[model samples]
Target: MKYKAERDCKTYLDTGRLFAPSSKSCHVGLNQVGSLPLEVRSWTCSNCKIKHDRNVNSAIIIGDEGLGLLALGTSTYCP
Candidate 1:
């Protein structure tokens, strides 16, 4: 017998845009940071054991609280 496990995954564009049918040019948390190296796709937080995508982690940092001061254009200021 053959068996396979299915996992849910979503792909984002190189520009950090979500691959949703209705997605716009909004800057998601993943886009602000950049792409993840092929080898370091996932990492565990030093303090927390939380597993995070390298790309997504960086984006979160870029969009962290108090980051509004560094806003560049509409991409950063978009509500």
Candidate 2:
């Protein structure tokens, strides 16, 4: 997106951190990789106690962070 959008897009260290079932409720965090699939079918937040569609939630996170990076002029990718 950084290259194609011609705008600053960042790969947040926390991008992949969203998928850990353990951190399902914790939301954002530092970089960490887990033994999870590339696309989870569904999930529920432990803390919030609410169900969520995996893809939708991920898009929200990625989009929010990407916009943040654009504001900072620090484009990046999901790694």
Query: Model 2, 21: alpha-carbon shift in Å?
Result: 9.8
Off by over 4 Å in 2: 1-40, 75-79
Alpha-carbon runs more than 4 Å astray in model 1: 1-38, 65-79
Predictions in order: lDDT: 0.37, 0.51
CA error at residue 62 for candidate 1, angstroms: 0.7
Structural similarity to truth (TM-score) of each candidate = 0.35, 0.47
What is the C-alpha RMSD, rounded to one decimal, of candidate 2? Answer: 7.7
* Error in Å for residue 56 of model 2: 0.5
Error of 2 at 9 (Å): 14
Give the lowest summed-lDDT range of ten residues in model 2.
23-32
> Over the stretch 1-79, how does candidate 2's per-residue lDDT look in tens digits?
4364434443433446554443222235422334446565665554465565656665666666657767887754543
Model 2: per-residue Cα lDDT at residue 65:
61
Residue 8 lDDT (model 1) = 24
